[model samples]
Target: MEIRWVEAFIAVAEELHFGRAATRLRLAQSPLSQTIRKLEKELGVRLFDRNTRSVALTPAGQAFLPHAHRVFEELELGRQSTRAAAGEVYGTVSIGFSGALNHLTLPPLTRAVRQRYPQVTLSLAVRVVTRDGIEQLEQGSLDIALVGLPIAPSSVRTRLIGREPLGAALPVDHPLSGESAVDLADLAEDGFITAPAESGSSLQESTLRACVKAGFQPRVVQEIADPYMILTLVSAGVGVALMPSNVAGIMPSASVFVPLRDEPTFMDHALAWRPDNPSPVLHAVLEVAEEVLPTPRT
Candidate 1:
């Protein structure tokens, strides 16, 4: 019920040993045991299944662990917000960026936050994919992340900030590969390699929508998860990849990516965060990002 009770529970839950948890909390073992007993008594459940040999969390304890961490997160947020309201905006914020599209706003956003709040520290983590960023955000390891639209969890809030135009990835020897610009309909009959529709990836959706608008449903020959693999498949003459054209220099040769000539389809990029997060440091960085790259509300 008390703050010290929550602290004791978390320490014990993490260490799984009364003595170790007490040492971590800088409290005597007897008192720490008493704290756990009091918490268990109040909750009317055994949080741990322990014997002299080893210790482990009970089913109830395992379920309660995440909620306990959330309690701490909320308290920390309150403290940070209070400090920020007092004109002391100084806290660490973790940001996750997976793709190059986020780079357009990262530098300017970082500079603006540094100038406005000299005390804040920005922590950057390069995630391998948008799903990785979204997972980190849900786990509370990251304050914000660049994610594709329609992420799985509704708990995450998003603000659209950028849109990268899509293009066709075709084999070098393909007839239309020589064109300066290609239309989506031109590839209607061509074999297509796309991301699975279940992934909710903007790349696949944009490609499909553009193709449908261009008067054809693509002949999908393969569905690959990784965009790089999709490109590699295209390079091998498997199928044309209608994806973000901006990723030209990263992959190997043997394929040509050209701009879409018809109504341009774009892969959307957005900044995603938990709405429950009250960290003033994250709020400050988001403010700067909103200003640096503004987009129409979706």
Candidate 2:
């Protein structure tokens, strides 16, 4: 009638001796006998041939053995499948990022994830900047994120992965491009391309601060969201922009990427996830990110 009763039936059927079956099941002989009796009563069939000297199975009991074993095996397999589905080694992850990450981080990040978690399907969304990415994360849209700025929300957990030094994008024919290294101040009179102030971009803020430190408030000529567009503007001599050194590697043609004289206004890159919604897969991905990011030099 119950699974325990089925187990008792199987035990006595296999051992043949009442005392031995009871011992194997860690039960008293009386209870094991009662359980077998109950199972036989429920099934309305005799399962054992009993004599004073020995016990043997009925044809029905022999027929039921394989079915009983199969039932238990199927149940265990179902439990194992559920656990595997919940494990870090399985499942899909969705990630969002500011456009800059496409050029500076995603290529390597994608390669690493593919190599390590080939079964984990990764989905990506291109965003304007850190603020946009964080908003998506908070809305339950992103499982993980690669953000370019500091995340202020206490509910959002993060890890600093790497830092890239700020560099300037300029036209090859521009006056200052001839210099081996250009001071941020040298472009004080130049028209500038920048992301909007309210965009919450750390790079925009850092670039502005660098200009102020170099002693001028930059004259804005264009406001663009995508880094590629910024490079296009520079290529057309529309204006100059400050970006991470990695951006230079993504350019299709030679513009000019000069190290800022200050040489290290770094844009910090971070891996972020929601603290409220913890995920084992996301945590594993974060670990991979931390492991792959370039290490800081002393």
**Candidate 2's residue-wise lDDT over 101-137, tens digit each?**
4565776777798899887678988764788778778
- What RMSD value applies to candidate 1? 4.0
TM-score of 2: 0.68
lDDT of each: 0.81, 0.78
Lowest lDDT sum, 10 consecutive residues, model 1, at 97-106
Given candidate 1, what's the lDDT at residue 212? 88
- How close is every model to the real structure, measured as TM-score? 0.76, 0.68
Compared with the true structure, what per-residue lDDT tens digits does model 1 show for residues 1-298? 8989989999999999999999999999999999999999989999999899888999999998999999988887788889888888888988877544455657777788889888888888863356767777788899988777756656789988777778888899899989999878878889999878776456777778889889998888999767777888888989888877656655448888888898887788888888878788888888888787688564
